[model samples]
Target: MTADRDLGSEARQMLAERTADLQAAEAANEALRRANAELRASRAALAASEARLRLALGAARMANWEWDPIADVVTGSEGREALYGRPPGSMRSAPEVLAAVHPEDRERCAATIRRAMERMPGEEEFDAVEFRVLHPDGSIRWLRSQGRITDRDPLTGRALRAAGVTFDITQRREAETRYRVLFDASPFAVIVIDQATFRILDVNTRACRDYGYSREEFLSLLITDIDVLGDEAAIRARGRAHKTGERTQEFEAVHRTRDGALRDVLVRVEGLDLGNGRVTYGAHIDITARKAAEVELRRSEERLRVALEAGGLGAWELDFSRRRTRWDARLAAILGRERVDAEVANEVLSRCLEPADLPAVQEAFRQAMATGGDFAAEFRILRPDGEHRWVRCWGRLLPDQHPGHRRMAGVVADVTEHRQAEERQLLFMREMDHRAKNILAVVQAALRLTPRHDADSYAAMVEGRVSALARAHTLLAENRWTGADLAALLRAELQPFLTAAPEAPEATRILLEGPALTVAPQSTQALGMALHELATNAMKYGALSTAGGHVALGWEVTGEALRLRWEERGGPPLAGPPPASGFGTRVIEATLERQLGGTVRRDWRPEGLVVEAMLPIGTIRAR
Candidate 1:
């Protein structure tokens, strides 16, 4: 029985142990199943992550690549061939990849790769290169590659593999080229400067030419160096203000060139934010000529002002389209009106004009406007003070490119003095005509009244009378037909008799005493004829017939009449008045009494002859 009980115990122990083994096996199987499920889940997550990476690379125009130096082969993502402008699998080998590189860049690319593969200890195994690739279609593409050694031989320390990313940079490069072209081709001088330092960073071709500096030289200068004022601190402050939008971008400043020539420039600045810092782009436009023109224009205007003031000219303008009239202060003074900003109505101007002159002035302006010609008018204007003035105006149309917008500008001047002079001249001419007629009538009367003796004697008498009248007429004309001087008339009529006695001086032969008085034109003629007759008779038969004879002619104003006397001495005696009424005696009496309204008397004295006359002052004196 003990032997049998021990056997059961052993069996049970073995069974329990087997049961424990079985349970452990089942637990091990469950762990294996959970591990498998976790792995599958991890794989799916990894695949999705890879898909996201590929999508990002594609969007960025990038491709992952691997290079095997030992095998001389290359591999990459699906679109890696496109970056090199090649078909899929065409650039699988290193040599094929090299052949696709542009001839200009192949050697450089190979050198870069060789350098990266030979990286020494303690040195970075990374490399970057930008190169071009040419395609079969005669097109080229630009690419950038960045890589690091992925695997290397431990003993040889040589690169076995490299991996990196490549991307298309053609668009970026083309944009840079276009910007460069435009920058160099700008018409206005352009410069790029660093905002912080005010240093010139870059300059275009125009900037170099305008500043009289080379591109390299300009790049070395500070912006303040070109400022003629050279206020560095203020300029820097302004630049800071511009960056902060505290000041306007455009300003005028004088800039100096390399040759020290100053230019008036209008500068316009634009701020560019380049992430690293702010830079300024400046454009300079030279306005030196325009500034000079403005100065000259001001000088010209000043000169015009001076000339107008000196000439007593009033400037005026009329704008027909706007119905506005503008005039300078002088014009307002001329029109006797208070100052106004602009004359708005034609009626206002018309009120200052004489009613009779307004129509003609209006017609002149109308004709000028119709023909686009000049306007000129002379008219009488009534001032506010009730003073009448004559004025002349001249105007011309201003040139205009647009129709119906004509403007006329001109000058006006007061011509009252000129008009008065013209009227006086006309009156004087008429007076001269009347005087000539009177003179002709007197000559006719003398010819008719003279007696007819022998033909030669009669002609001589007529010529003598006519000559006397001519002398009187000449004296009247000299005085503008106003009057003749009495002393001058006496001297002229007695000149022949006084000079006939050459042995005796004129003072010894003749005496003239009279106060200076202007005789009327009519009285001068009558007295001149009477004196001629008496002097002729004296020469022929009285005092002048002898050399020792003398004559005294004198006049004085007494009350309202003038009394004149003629006396001859030291000559053969005149027995009495002529025996009969003679032509010379009658001429003297008729001229003095009938023409001058005066009385004449003769005395026959033993020594010589005497004559006396009395006339009303009104008839003898010049009025």
Candidate 2:
């Protein structure tokens, strides 16, 4: 029984050991199954991800390419080959791909790749550098190449693979070229500035040449340097406009040139927000010459105004369409009215004219307008002070280019002094001629009255009288036949003999008195000769002989006649009124009779000599 029991125990132990081993084996098998299932799932997921990547690449028209620098082999999508302008399967080697690169850009592309490999072996890199490639059809297209370093082979010290996307940007590049041609060739000067730095970013050839600066130099300058406002104001304003997206309009200001000279310019500034930041564009038009011309025209107008005022001429303009009349300040002042209300029309202006003169003035204006020619009229204006003044109106009507807006403009001048002078000249000519005839008759009479044996004395007296008459005419001519002052006349004709010698006359010997008055031309001539004759006689033998002798001269204007009284006191003795009919005495009588149309009396009194003359006021008034 013990042997049997021992055998069973040995069998059971072996069976248990076998069972444990089986369980361990099953566990190991189950774990292996799970790992196999996980591996399958991972493979499926990877396949799905690759499919999605291909779809995305196709949708985006993007091509993936790999380049192995060591093996010189390139692997890429069909689209990549298309972008490279190469035949399908043609870019299997680096050399094959490089063969399509433009000759001009081959060096640049090689250099960029070399630098990228040295800097970043297994890291990604990208660049938008422009490159050219030969098309499959023998044409050339511009392209923007982009790439990444995918892997590096450690054993070869070379690129294992580089992945990149290349897009055909030929149309974009062509459009840019077309736009650049237009932008550079525009007539208007255009500039673009970086808002942040206020630095000039881009300028065309015209802008550079206009500013007298080179393109590189212009890009280095700040916007404020050439800005119309200049300095900080320009910077601040440009910043504000850029931030607000505002479009500035024409503003007149000055800009500084490269040489620091200021030029008047009209500027229009605009802001462009380009998502990344801001840019400012400006257009400039030089207005310096136009401004100078406007200034010169204003100065010329001012000079003309000064000349008109100095000449005392009044200017006016009439607007026929509006029935309005415009007058300058001087014109208003001449008409004795305030300047502000001077633009009134014909109604008010007509009231300023005399009743008879108003008709003549209206006729003149009508004729001027009808003929489009010059018209002149002399008329009288009734002043506010109840006085009449002679006015000469001269005008020229200009034909209007506008159908209904013809007008007349002209000047008005006061001709009172001029008219009076004309009248005086006419009267003096007639009177002087009449006096010459009368004087000749007197000479004839004197010659007849003198004895035949006294021919020499008679000739002397006639000659002296004619010379005195001539002297009077010379004095009248100096005054333009207008008039002569009494004091000036006396001094001119008598002062020479009164102070002929160094000895001064007695204090009481000469007397002269009168208020300031203008004597007529006729009166001047007549009185001048009479006074000259009297002075000559007095210096010869009358009141001027000694210190005790005295002469008195007085004159008065009374209505129609001017009365003159000459008295002599304490002469050499009592002079009996020029006992002989000498030249001096005859001249005095003739002047008073003919020129003055008055009488002269000579008194031979025991008390020296006395002479008095009375003349008509009208005759003297013509002076």
Candidate 3:
């Protein structure tokens, strides 16, 4: 019974141990199942992270690459082929990758990789390089690669593997090329300067030419060195302003060239942020010629002012469209108007013109406007004080820069004195012509009327009459041909024929009596001839035949007539009127009656012949 009980216990104990082992096995199976689920979740998370990294790399135009130095192999992500301008899976080895690099950059890239692979202990294994790659389309592209040794040989401590990223830098390189092209192609001088040190960093082709400096020389100079004023403080202030967000600054400054010649320039400074630091781009526009022209223009205007003032010239402008007239103070004075700054209405100027001159002036202006030609006009103006003045204007059309806009500018002057002088000269010419004709007519008449009984006597008579005319002309000329004094005329005609008596001088030989009256030029000629004939008769046969003889010529103005009597005494007496057809008597009658509108009568007196004449004052006297 003890043996059987021990066998049951052993069997139950064995069964419990088996049950424990099965439970432990079930527990281990559950743990294995849980671990499998966690491994699957971790794998999914890892896959999602890798996908994000690839997506990021693709978006950034970058690709992951690995280079194996020992095996001479190169491996890259999916987009690495495109970055290298190659077909998919074409770049498989280091030699192929090196062949893809540009011929100009292949050697440099090989050297860089070799150095990176031979890196020593405690030294950086980082490798970075920028190079050009050959594109399949016969174009070159820029690329940047950065990597480090991922694995190294323990014994040699040398690089065994490297991994990095490559990206497309073609766009950035092309942009830099375009910037350089524009920088050198500018017309105005362009200079690049370091903001902090005020040092000249670079210069364009124009800057080199304009400043008379070579490219090397320009690069060695400071910005302050070219400033003629050398105001370093001001330059620093401007730089500071630019650094503080001022995008642009402009000013006028004088700059010196390499030859030490100063130039006037308009400088425009623009701030550039080149990632490293702030720099300034200065564009200098030379304005030296413009400044000189402005100065010359001012001087020319001043010279014109002086000339105008000296010449007594008055400037005027007429705006046809606006119907307004503008004039300087000098012109206002000439027009007898108060000086005003504002333009006057055309009607105001027209009102100042004489009625007879307005039409002419208007027509001249109209023709000038119509033809776009020169304008010239001379007219009379009635001043406020009722004084008449003559004015002249000269003008020409202004340039026609704008179509349909007509303008003329010119000068005006008071020409009253000049006009008067011209009129005087004309009148003098006419008067001289008339006088010459009249004198010739008189001389011809005398020559025809003189008797030809003897050649000597006829010639003498003609000469005497001509002498009388010349004497009268002399008196007229002395009075500017306006008129001849009556008394002076009588004296000139009779003075040569007078002779002194025993007790009396030549002054008493003949008598002339008249008031201070002047005879018209025409009347003087006629009257002079008559007086000469009478005096010749007197000296030959009348009172003046003897030394003691005397003649009295007297006149008095009455009503509208001048009554004169020529009385002779103490010499030959006149028997009754001799032949009425004598040359001397005919001449006196013709002159006093036909020419002078007067009556001539002779009274035969016992003492001497007495002559009386009644002359119309209007016909003989000067007005």
Per-residue lDDT tens digits for candidate 2, residues 1-623, read 99999999999999999999999999999999999999999999988987887777666656777777777788876567777766688778867776779988988887877777775454556744678888768888876767867676677656666777776677888998897788789776678888678888888777776788898999889877886566776657644654433445456667777887787876677878889889878777678888898899899888889888888888888777778888888877778877745467767778888988888788887887777779899998887878777889888877668978877888989887888778866877787687678667755765665345577856765565556556666666787656778766765666545542235533545678866667776577677778877877777778777666768888888888888888887777763555468766766777788657898878878877788888887877653
User: How does candidate 1 score on lDDT?
Assistant: 0.85
Q: List the candidate numbers ranked by TM-score, top first.
A: 2, 1, 3
Highest lDDT among the candidates is held by which one? 3
Per-residue lDDT of candidate 3, residues 1-623 (tens digit): 99999999999999999999999999999999999999999999999988998898888889999988778788988789898889988888878888889989999998988787677766765788889998889888899998988877789887787899899998999998899799889999999999888889999989999999998999998989998657779876754554524578887778999999999988888889999999988899999998889899999978987888888788877776778878888888898888869987878878989999999988998898888889999989999999999988899878866766667789888888899878966987898898798778878888887889999988888888888888888888888777888888888898887668877763588878779888987788888889999999988888888878899999989999988889999987566767655788888888899888899888878799889999999988887
Candidate scoring better on TM-score of 1 and 3: 1
Error of 3 at 163 (Å): 4.6
Q: Candidate 2: list runs displaced more than 4 Å.
A: 1-60, 76-78, 118-125, 138-140, 148-163, 212-214, 224-230, 233-245, 253-263, 288-453, 499-515, 529-533, 536-541, 545-570, 575-623
**lDDT (Cα) of model 3:** 0.86
TM-score of each: 0.56, 0.70, 0.53
Q: Identify the runs in model 3 with alpha carbons over 4 angstroms from their true place.
A: 1-36, 66-75, 87-98, 105-130, 147-163, 174-229, 235-250, 257-261, 268-283, 316-357, 379-391, 414-623
Alpha carbon lDDT of each predicted model: 0.85, 0.75, 0.86
Residue by residue across 1-623, what tens digits does model 1's lDDT show? Answer: 99999999999999999999999999999999999999999998999988988888888889999989888889998788877777898988878878888989999988988888778745655699889988678788889888988887889878788899999898998998799899989999998999889899999888888989999999889988998767778886655655535433877788999999999988888888899999988898888998888899999978988888888778888888877788888878888887668576756777889999999999999999998889999999999999999999999999999887889999998888879877856866786677678768867877887777688887988888888888888888798677999999988877766664667554467889989999987688888988999889888888878888888999999998899999999889767777787777887877788877888888889888889999889999998
Error of 2 at 524 (Å): 2.3
Q: Positional deviation of 156 in candidate 3, in angstroms?
A: 11
